[model samples]
Target chain A: MTGWLSIFKREFRAYFATPLAYVFIVIFLVLSGVFTFFVGGFYERGQADLLPFFAYLPWLYLFLIPAVAMRLWAEERKSGTLELLMTLPIGISGAVVGKFLAAWAFTAVALGLTFPLVITVNFLGSPDNGAIVSGYLGALLMAGAYLGIGAAVSATTKNQVVAFVLSVTVCFLFTVSGLEIVQAFFPDAVGKEVAKFSFLTRFNDISRGVLDLRDVIYFATLIGFWLFLNRLFLDNAREAG
Target chain B: MAPRLEARSLVKRFGPITAVDHISLKVEAGEVLGFLGPNGAGKTTTMKMLTGFLDPSEGEAYVGGVSVADDPERAKRQIGYLPEGAPAYGDMTPRGFLTFAAETRGLTGAARDAAVARAVHALSLDRVIDQTIETLSKGFRRRVGLAQAILHDPDVLILDEPTDGLDPNQKHDVRNLIDGMRKDKAIIVSTHILEEVEAVCTRVVLIDRGRIVFDGTPAEFRGRAEGAGTLRVILPADAVEDAVEQFEDLDEVSAMDRHPTPDGRVRFTLTGDDRIALINRVTGVIDGAGWPADELELDAGRLDEVFRALTSRETDHQDSNQGQEVRA
Candidate 1:
């Protein structure tokens, strides 16, 4: 736990030490606001819930989360600092957990900044706060899942752009699994199975004022599975070098 | 005392290229061992294996008797490694980077702060600790790297070219710092500069083409090329063979070389570590042989010559072996 916390602190401070965190937060806020109010027609829909805001989150994170997590290990490898970190006393798992938590927390901070939208909705209408709270919870969990994949991809290469593009491509696959065009490629039963495994479907279930135990386990399991792969990648690189 | 660091039959290969080929070495505590090799000589590869950054394809490396492959974390706890290029996050300042290293080493609260302070003070990074690493000079960046490596005060330090790009003053200070920590730790420093090794290293392991050709103290290494007692006599051109015959009875002067100069004088070169004895015998022979010589001097052995001889022979042997393999 201490090892993880130490890595987390280093990673968190690393974001602030440069212009990355501020730039990410600013871009995230402006885009989320623009997408929710203008693009998704939040005011036009006139819904009492945060449907417009939550709907754009998965898409926004697809690009923005990769931007944040792309450099986590890729930059370390490019700069040859990965060897320095790997030679430390901490295990590879600890380093992965530490880095993943830091990036996830940074994304949470970006998520938290959008609370004004919650406040704005609460003041103007009698929206169900339970659903809004669950929507935010789902957003946070989905971020962890996406960032876990991003972190795993980041460990595979020294090129940040390569890491970013590969992760975004993979995340896109998981996001569109439930869509009709994607499901059409599979047989009827397999298509249904693919749709059921889609990230959008599971995330949408929680955003609809329903926090199912299965959704929680799904996202957590996905995150854990990717994190395990991240560790394995790190171990392989350490041995290979 | 047991060796502070040891590698037994360590081997590493990348596809067909073997970087470190079943090399073994040991350094006792308080010894500054120089790792000498040319570029592409697998010096850095050996250090990485020792530091547990790269697992050996076969065999094992140990720090304080803990196997790097089996128990890397425990072994690494006793090691401080400064890799080539001394890479660190450019976004982080020295203070922030050192603090991160401290925290990773499990130092916390007051202890962490104290460790950071001590490292900063030791490296004299007062003015630059707050500046981003990207803005610092090469010397200051090297110091920051040194600071982090020593912050934990590990018992084994595996440094790859620690003073590669430093100014003379910075190099002196770094050498002194490593020397001062010698009694408490074992330091293995690799460098291309022979003077740096001569200044600080107590022993040296001269590696050539992934093999250790020489492993001994500095003085012992210099003593290798001392040849069969051969003497050169300097005399007038006509008296060369007479001077040589005069020294033939001396057992210490087993062989002789008398080369005639353009100026009509013969110059003799002597080969032997016992210069005084050789000189005395030559003088006795010269006085008895009635040969008048203009000048005689002793030759100083150069490390550059030794390095060339060692690396070239190894490369030639490797090429011949490959040629034979192709023929087969």
Candidate 2:
């Protein structure tokens, strides 16, 4: 427990120890505000709920979460600290999960700061707080899903810029794969599978106030699968030096 | 009790290339093993396997009796390693990093605090404990890495080029640290500094081409130099046959080579480790034979030459003067 828990404590504190946490939180709050009020037309489409605000959380996370995760393994690899970290007594899986949870919790904090939208909606009209809770839950899961992919991609390269671009590209595919237009690029049979696996589709489902067990399990497995790949890459990628 | 650390026929292969080939080592407590090898000779790979950071391709490494491959967590718990570059977290302060190392190594509460304090004091990191590692100088960062490795005070410690980038004073300090801890920990240190072997290593293992070419005491390594007790003896050509017979029979002469000088004198070059006695014996033989000889000289022995001779031809970059230029 000390080995695993200490990694979580260290990585989490590391986020706040530098300017990264403040910068990320401020940017996240500003962008979510801009996209919600002006771009998504939160006021004009007001039926007394945060649907307009929740609609763009996926797109906002598409870039921001990767920015937070770009340094996860890429920075370690670049500075050669990956060797130091791996040689520690902590199991690699524990380190991976701890690091991933730290990032997830940081994003959750950034997402949590958007509670003003819930307040504004409830003040204006009768809003279902339960749906707002589910929306936040779905958004956090989607962010974790994005972070999982970003961390795995980050493990593949030492250049953080390359990690950012690769993560954004992969996450974008998972984000829009279920869209009607994007699905047309695939064969009819393959298109259905792509839709079923699309992250935004799951987000939309859970945010609608119906939290299916399978949907929760799907997101969990997605995060798990990416984390598993992240570990495999670390095991082989760190062998060179 | 089992050896503190051991590597049994450890082999690591990348593609068709065998980085560490059939390497086996046993490091017991109270011994500081100097891992001597030129660059690309697989010193880093062997240490990586011993620490359970890299799995061996063909064999096993044991840290305190647990096989690293079969149970890396338990094996790794007993070994503390510093990789080739002494990598550290640049964004973390020394205080934060050492505390993290202590906690991860399973030290908690007062014990963890004491361990961190001891490591910091041992490495003299008190001045820059709060400084971010990236902002610290290279020497300080290297010290921070050492502090992290030794915070737990494991029974087996493996450091790769621990003093690679330090100044003379810092090098002496690190050497003393290793020496001070040698009574309890089995340590393996890989270095290109030939003098460090003499200063710190209880036994030296000279590796070349992924194989152990020479393993012995430092004195033995020096004796194997190109000219430990080498002598140049010039005598009349008529007496060369009789001199050769007498010199060949003497056990003091390990090897002898003959050359014909332009002045019709024969020069015999003799190599031996018993220097004082070799000179005395050769001079007596010359005096007893009633043969006038000239130009008798002995070399003081060169360790750098011995290093290159024992390694491979790839060591052309090695300095002949000494360890002044033997950088890996």
The numbered model that scores best in lDDT is: 2
Best by DockQ: 1
Model 2 lDDT at residue B45: 86
Give the C-alpha miss distance for residue A99 in model 1, angstroms. 0.2
CAPRI classification of candidate 2: medium
* Complex DockQ, candidate 1: 0.70
> What is the Cα root-mean-square deviation between model 1 and the actual structure?
5.3
* Candidate 1 C-alpha lDDT tens digits along B1-328: 4579999988888888888888999988889999998887889999999998887889899888888888888898899889998988898999899999998898989999999999999889999989999899998988889898999988999888899789999999999999899997899999999888778999989987688888987655655544423445567878766666666666666455666688878787766555557778777777776667666665535666677777787567668788665320
User: What's the lDDT for all of these models?
Assistant: 0.85, 0.88
**Candidate 2, which segments miss by more than 4 Å at Cα?**
A186-190, B229-300, B315-328
Which lDDT tens digits does candidate 2 get at residues A1-241?
Answer: 2266888888889999899999999998999899889998988985887877788888989999999999999998988888888888888999899999989988988888988888888889998888888888888889999999999999999999999999999999999998999888999999999998898888887788867888888889999999999999898776765
Candidate 1 residue lDDT tens string, A1-241: 3378888988988888788999999999999999999998988988778898888889999999999989998898888899999888988788899999999999999999999999999888889999999999999999999999999999998899999999999899889998899988999999999987788887887888899988889999999999999988887766555
Two-chain DockQ for each candidate model = 0.70, 0.59
For candidate 2, write residues B265-311 as lDDT tens digits: 99999988777678889988999998988988877577777888887
TM-score of 1: 0.87
| Candidate 2, lDDT over the whole model | 0.88
Clashes of 2: 0
